[model samples]
Target: MEERPNNDTTISTDEINVLLGKLKFSEEESVQIMSTNDGKNVKGFESWAVGKIMATEHPNREAMYRVFKSLWYTKEEVDFVALKEGAVIVKFGCLEDRSRILKLMPWLFDKCLFSMVPFVKGKNIASYEFGLSPFWLRVYNIPIELMDRQLVVAVGNAIGELVAIDWKDRNGAWTEFMRLKVKIDISKPLRRIVKLVSRYGGETIEVIKYERLPDFCYMCGLIGHTFKNCKDNREGAGINDSNAQYGSWMRAPFVNPNQERNMRRNGVEIVKTTITANEDKEESQTNSRDESGQSAQKGNEKEVKKARYRHHLWKKEVISLYMTAWDGLSIRGSA
Candidate 1:
C-alpha cells in the first residue's frame, strides 16, 4: 500500500495491482496516490476509507495508494456539479455559480483584445454566440483555462448576484464543458470600441498620435506641451513671448539664449567662427596681453633703430669703397 502525504499540494504516479484494491481503509490516508487497476469493482471506493484498508495488507503502502487512485481517479478535475435537474449545485472545479462569470468582463475584454477579436460588447450578443453571460455583456476570444473557479464565485459574491444560473439546456440533459459557452449583456462595453475604431481608422499615424498628443507644445507646434505649461520654461527661462513675432516658440522672446538678437547683443554669435560670446571675449583679451602698452612703445623703438642703422651703414660703405678705388687708380698711374 502507498503512504499518504499530509501536505495539501502534491500527487504521485505510482502503480498498484488488484490485491491492494480488495483491502479497505480511510480516504485521508489515500491522498497523493497513484494506482493501476487489475480489475473493476461494482461498488465505488471512497478517498479516505481506501487508504486505511490497504495500509494493513501492503507494507510498502505505495501499492495500496496506487490501487486506490487507479480505480477512483481522485485528482481534482475541472467539472460541473448539478444541484437540480438543469442547474449546477457545486461551484468548485468546472461547476461554478453563474454570477461568478459576470464579473469577468474586464478580464474577458482584455483577453478578447489580446486574441485580436475585432469587436467585443454585450448588446445583441447572441449574434457572436458567446453563449450565456450574466453581466448582460461579454468579450469574446477569452481562454477557457484562464477562468478560475474561485474567481468566478468571487465575482458573483462581489456583485451580490448569481453570475449565471448554470442551467442545462431546456432538454434537461447534463451539459459537458465542450458544449458550454457563457451568455452575458454586451451593450455598454461595445461603445468603447466605436470610439477606439473611429480613431484607429481615422488617424493614419496612430502611434505618433497617441504617444505624441500629450507632449505637444501649442506655442511651438512641438511635443510635450506649450511653454506656458512647460516646466523647463518656468525654471529660469526669465522671459516670456506673449507677443510672438514669428508665430513660433523660437522667434518668440521666451528666454531662449539661441535667439539671434540675444546672441548678437552678447557677442555670442561669432560671424567668422562658431565661438560663443565668452570665447570671443577671451580671444580679444589674449591679443592684448601687454595691457600696460609697453609692447607698443618697444615696437616703435625697434623700427626707429632699424632705419637709423641702415642709413649709417650705407653711407660708410659707399665712402670707403670710393677711397679704395681712387687709391688704386693713382698707384697704377704712378707705376
Candidate 2:
C-alpha cells in the first residue's frame, strides 16, 4: 500500500522525482559508454552521414544503439558517441539508416524524448543553423560611457555575426525586461584576438569558448529557439520577417541612469570584502605553516570553512535581491 503525500510535508515524491530527472550526466560514468566498432578505423559516411541527437538525460550507448537496431532490424547495426552536453553523435552503418532516422524526425527511447538534427561534417554546428553565427566576446574594463547601442553594434559588426549584447542592468521598470541573449556556434574553432580596434583603440577583448550560448524566443517567450523560428503561433497570428522586430524591452536601453553609482558602491564593498578575505587566508596559511609542519591539512580545513561561510552569505544576498526584484516585477506587471 502506498501512503499519500501529506500536505504538511516539505517536498512530495513527485517533486523529488522532478529534481532527479534534471540531474546532469556524470562524465565519469559516460567515459566507458562507447558503442562497439567492428574493427573499422575510419568513419564510413564522414560528414554527410551523422545525426546529432539531443535529450534531457544522456542516453546509454547500448540503449541508443538499440533504438537504431530496432529500426534497422539488425542486432549490432548502429554506432554512437555521447557528447558532454547530453547530445549524442550516432553514425549508422549505411546511408539508409541515416535516412530512416531523419524521416522519423523526433525520437523516443526508454521514456526519454529526443530531438534529432543532421550533423554536417567539416563545417561547425553554427553553419547548420539558419540565423547569425554565434560567439561570446568579453570586453575588459569597458568604459561605462561607451556601453550603449553604438558600442554593441560596433563590436557585433566586428565579429562575423552581430546577434545581440549580453549584459542587462535595468534602467527602467523591472516588469517587462528579460535577460540579454546571443547566438553561439558550437563547431567553429574559437578565435581569440586580444586587441579590439574601435574609436577607443587598444581595448583588449577576450573571447572565451562556452559549451552553450543564449537561446531565447521573444515571440513565444521560450528558451530553446529564437523569435524567427518560434512555432508558438501556427495559425493566423504567425510571426514573419517584416513583423519580426524586438519587443519593448529589447528596443530600449536596460541600464538605469543611476545604475553606475549603485554599481560603484556595490563593487567597492564586494572588492574590499574579497581582498580582506584573501589576505586573511594567506596570513592564516602562513601562521599555520610556521606553527606546525603539516599545513596541508590545516589549509584544507580553513578553505572548506571559508568556502561554506562565503557560499551561505552569497546565497542569502542573492535570495534577498531576487525577492526584491520579483516584487518590483509583480507591481510593474499589474500596471
lDDT tens digits, residue span 1-335, model 2: 99887775555456778998888869885577667965343336442243433222334556555544544442226667764334466676655556544432233343233445556655543334422233334443444555565555554454444443333333431122212222433233233332455575556553322212223454643334455565565666756556744332322223332453332111111222333457667666677787787775566556545654553454333333332332243233233
Off by over 4 Å in 2: 1-43, 46-53, 59-61, 74-76, 125-335
| Number of the predicted model whose lDDT against the real structure is largest | 2
Error of 1 at 117 (Å): 18
Worst lDDT 10-window in candidate 1: 47-56
Assess each prediction's global lDDT (C-alpha) against the native: 0.27, 0.42
Q: Distance from true position, residue 9, model 1, in Å?
A: 42
Per-residue error for 169 in candidate 1, Å, reads 39
Candidate 2, lDDT over the whole model: 0.42
